[model samples]
Target: MIMLSDWHPDIIEFIISKMQNPRILRYLLENTEDEQIKKAAQDKLKFTPLTAQEQDMYQGIINYKQIPGLGGFSDKIIKEAEEKLRTGGTYSVHNSEFLTGANISVCLTSDFMEAVENDEEYSLRFPDVEKYDEEEMKFYNENWHEIGDVREWEQMGYKVRTYRKMRAKELWNLINVCATYSAEPGIFFIDNANDMTNAKAYGQKVVATNPCGE
Candidate 1:
């Protein structure tokens, strides 16, 4: 066991962030003067029912949901999970302290473009769109991996193209939100990156770049 005195305030706050063990948490709660750490500890005590095992494995599993924008998870599922966790349910958040401080980058392509073209208010929320060159368009077209049935749109005589509007309104929305919260979400032009990567010859798509997008 790491001694309480040996741990820095930040480390103590990190332990508080992962307050799965009430005994250890209570010890920290009594020892620490940080309000945020204390509040986190209190929240854990309020939401989680104490068991002999400390951590509720099954409850954590049932309450699991991925964070949206950060992941491709739907809003509905995340909402349901939040509801569950809100009312005396347990959820395991790996490296929860990372939420406090971590270098995170978000990538988007097709969904962003679609929102900009179709959603009027969404479009007005950000910068104006500009046309991409032929080469850029070709790369944009190959960026997002198509899923589900495309035949229906084709049969209906609808243009089932991906690069019709290469707008960054939705991406801007993400950037703005991150900016508001003082979070770092470095933009990665995944489509262009993938097209230019030497990994293409080896039959690999570069879905994400390095932390610095190098």
Candidate 2:
């Protein structure tokens, strides 16, 4: 048996790369602070090809949900998409290209559709402003709205930045851009979806669908 001291970093990393047991790999991923060892364990866990049996086991499983709606878009999100587009050296009229590249399917709600029809403004709230540390406060102060008249939020024991609103024309423009450029971001009436769902009686609301629309 090899002593613990006999196992050098290179030997441990080689062993980790060859390790087939997922539990040991996961334990090393979580418990180890050595960055190289952690990366080796993570790479082994993440990049290893699944066997035919493993693929068959997860064939029909809906493991991920993509929930994108009106409230999901923000300045930070937009900037990230812009940076990604720039770095990728791709030019597109719509940001939905990023979502498509990321394999994210959007399901717009009834409220979003109604807002488009009625020309209602879209509002975004920055929550938990009171909990921000110095660095966070500085970043938000530079990038987001200034804190003002937070009496209502403060009364509720939560301080927040002044809410921002986008005009109805902007929302319509987004839809038109998506339609023209990407032909994506599918719409689903959430109320109708929940009404048809069997889990409503269990006090569970259907918020989003998996990639397979199940």
Q: Which candidate is the best by lDDT?
A: 2
Query: What is the TM-score of candidate 2?
Result: 0.36
Worst 10 residues of 1 by lDDT: 1-10
lDDT of 1 by residue, 16-121 (tens): 4433444444554575544554566566553344453433533444344433353555667556545554444553433445444444454444444456577532
Whole-model lDDT values for every prediction: 0.43, 0.44
Q: Model 1 — TM-score against the truth?
A: 0.30
lDDT of 2 by residue, 21-57 (tens): 4455566566654455567656656433445564443
Clash count, candidate 1: 0
Task: lDDT for model 2, please.
Answer: 0.44
Q: Please state the error at residue 209 of candidate 1 in Å.
A: 1.9
Provide C-alpha RMSD values for all models, in order.
Answer: 20.5, 24.4
